[model samples]
Target: MGRILLTGASGFVGGAIHEYLSNSSTHKLTVALRRPMSSLPVTTTLAQIDQIDGVTDWSRALLDSDVVIHAAARVHVMQESSTDPLTSFRKVNVEGTLNLARQAAEKGVRRFIFISSIKVNGEETSLGVPYTACAEPAPADPYGISKMEAEKGLMRIASESGMEVVIIRPPLVYGPGVKANFFNMMKWLYRGVPLPFGAICNSRSLVALDNLVDFVVTCIDHPKAANQVFLVSDGDDLSTTELLKKMGRALGKPARLLPVPSGVLTLAATLLGKKTLSQRLCGSLQVDITKNRELLNWLPPVTVETELDAVAKDFLDKHV
Candidate 1:
């Protein structure tokens, strides 16, 4: 078994990846964290890195590590006080990521798997047209731009060195311990709260946490995944109305949706300075996973329905 170095092991998505890696005996896992946690598996090594930024040293952690799975980054913040959001994002996401990758290459790490976001292609997709790996990048926000830049930098490092680089761009990821909008949606669905999204006909592609980890584990050794960018989803696209209805069913509650006009909802959101939130609910953001399926023959191990049930169960447990 080879050694795998995982960064951002204590974060939301990273925490899930850490759990998955720690349980597996296939690879000896070394987790890089800002601070130690109490419940990490006994087999895993905890390497504390004070902060991940432009100058954070990673030489010690990369030594003897066969693969580097980089799941750490400065994700989108709701209320960022930084004067320059792009600069702040670049500091951690771009600069810190490249520094680690370069050091890993120097230290003879065979493969580097980077978990990126679909925002690199833009926030919304046109109806029936899903984002693909070959799409011309049109990053809409500072966070997306930073990820795009990091992708380019990693590819350059891969070219100069022999280290194989794999990039996976995932859409909204949801599962147990999901927070933010998905968590709120589950709570509202569980309580049977009436939502005004019945008329919004937008298709979104989301990935279950398990499915993402499965793919990342596969890429750790898959030869075909090297030097390629992949856009991943659950292979199940659903409209906003369909999502809420399924969520309600998972929660054992009525969908309870009011058929409000999409225009009215958008206008109200605009008046309340929540245009982006409304657009997220009313917009289409689908990704084509044809490459992942055809090349790697990778199918999502967990179904969306199964993951939705897990989310509902977790929410109920917390509320109770």
Candidate 2:
């Protein structure tokens, strides 16, 4: 078993990874936290750091690590009032990631696995043409640009230092403890709130929390994952209306959906300054994971239906 160092142990995705690694006997895990945390899932050595910024020192944390899985990043904010949003994102996502990679390489670490977003491709996709691993990057937003730059820097570092770097770009991940848009959708479905997604025939690719964590753990030791960029999903694509209907079934409620024109929805959101959210609902964003499956022989272990039921059950268990 190899010694692994994981960042972002307290966050949603990281917490899932930590729990899975803790339950397994394949690797010894250590987690770096911004503050002291109690009742961690794994029996791991803790390294305390103030923040993951440009100047954060990660030398001590890299002392005896074999692999580094970076799961922490400054996610995109809807209304970022910062004067320089790109610079702020770079400080934590790009600079901080490079700092950790450099330290790990110096300490003889074998691999670095970076958790990236599918936004690196673009916010939306054209109908029927899903993003592939070989697609040229077209990062539109500042957050995507920062992740793209970080990926480039990691590649350069790997070429120079001979440390294997694996980059996995995942679409929206949802499960029992999910938050943000996915969580909001679950809540609305449970409450039987009417939605205007009946006419939104846009396909979206999403990954389950367990599937993402499973792929990440596999990358830690997989020979074919070395120095590669992969796009991961649940291996099933669904339209917006279909997703909501499935969610309603899981919650034991009828999908109270109204058939609304996509144009009208976009115009209304534009007037309300929520154009991005509307686009996300109306536009297609699918990813093709053929390369990962063919190369690594990996498939998502959990189906979307099973995960949605799990999420619905958890929501009811908490609220009822």
Candidate 3:
């Protein structure tokens, strides 16, 4: 069994990775948290992390560790109101990452896996082409800018150190234990309120929790994953209306979609400053995983339909 150190063990993506890797007899995992975080399947306690300096104690965590998955990041909304969003993100995302990575390098950690978001490219999807792994990062928000900058920093670190850096930039992820907009959608759908996204035909790439966990573990051992940037998804696209319908079926409810035109909804949302919500639903943000397929010879095991169904059922079970 190989020992791995993970950060952000208490969050949604972090929790999923911990649970998934813990089940494997070949992997021994340690999660690092700033303080005590509960409601996790794994055991954890307070640990020391250097907030700054040319010196740090993080190398200790890297001792005998096989891989370091830096899942911890300053999420956008969590630190939105700060005076300098970019600087705040840098403090946690960039500086914190270097602290951990430098330690891993000193201690001879084999692989450094970073969980970066597709937002580094852009938040909205384009009409002609989907985002690819090679696309130049043009993050419009603070979160995206921080991640893109960190990628550069890690690259420099990897060149100097022997540790291999693997970057996996994934699009929107949804499934059981999902939060954010997907969770909000579930709540709206359960209320049987008619949604006006029926006419929107934008496509989005979504990865299920199970599928994302599987991909990350695969990268840990895959010889091709080293010094590589990869993009992963369920290899299928789903529209907003289709997603609602699938979710409804999983919850044993009917999708109440109104056949309103997309343009009309856009106008209404614009008037109310609900532009963000409208863009999210009607955005054609898709990711091209051709490189992932060719390089890793891997495809997601779970389908979007099955994943949405699971989410719906889980939501109802919790709320009902």
Candidate 4:
């Protein structure tokens, strides 16, 4: 059994990974958190880290770690408060990640798995032209830029220290306990709120939380996953209208959608200073996962319909 160190046990993606790994018999898991959490399994080891920055010491947590899954980061915020947003993101996502990686390498950690975002590839893509693993980096936002920088630094550390770095970039992970935009969409659908995205034909790729967790666990010991960059999704791409309809079916509520023109929606959003939001709703962003299939022989374990059903059930159970 190998010892695995997991950071960001309190966040959405990290928490899901922690839960999945907690039931595993093959690995000893250590969770690094800003503070102690009462909900973690009793046998789980806790490493308290108040903050993550270039200067934050991770010596205690790096002990005897065979694999380090760095999942914590300064996620994008809707209303950013920092005067210098890029610097703020760099401090936590870039500098903090490299700091942890360097320390993990010194501690003889064999593998470092980084949970990155699809934003590292770019904000959007052509309808049929998906970004592949070898795509040129074109991060458009501060959060994406920070993650890209972190990936570059990790690669350097891997070359210099002989530590394996596996990077997985996933887009719009959704399932149980999802928050923000996805959750809002579920709420709107459940409440029978009519949306103006019925006619949007742009495709977007999304990852199910279970599928992502399964892939990450597989990568923990898979020889082919070492020092590799992977782009992951549900193996299914859906337009906004299709997604809403699927979600409505899952929620047992037929969606009430108005046939609004995409151009008109974009214009309205632009007038209201929500151009980015409109783009996200109307623009296509897809990732090609052929490399993942050929290299690791991996496929998303869960189907989109099944995962969306779970999401709908969870939302109904908790929110209703």
Worst 10 residues of 2 by lDDT: 36-45
Q: How well is each residue in 1-320 modelled by candidate 1, as lDDT tens digits?
A: 89999998888888888988888989999999878888777778888899888788997787689999999999997677899999999999999999999999999999999999999999999989999999999998899999999999999999999899999999999988998999888888777789998888889999999899899988999999999999999999999999999999988997899999888998999999998888789889999999998999999999999999998898889884
TM-score of each: 0.98, 0.97, 0.93, 0.99
lDDT per residue as tens, model 3, 151-174: 888888899997899998888888
Candidate 3's error at 11, in angstroms? 0.6
Where does candidate 3 clash, by residue pair?
A: none
lDDT of 3 at 188: 83
Stretches > 4 Å off in candidate 1: none
* Candidate 3, superposed: residue stretches over 4 Å from native: 36-56
Q: Model 4, 267: alpha-carbon shift in Å?
A: 0.9
Ranking by lDDT: 4, 1, 2, 3
Residue 158 of model 2 has an lDDT of 100
What are the per-residue Cα lDDT tens digits for candidate 2 across 258-310? 99988999999999999999988888999999998999999999999999999
By lDDT, the best candidate is 4
State the RMSD for candidate 4: 0.8
Best of the two (1, 4) by lDDT: 4
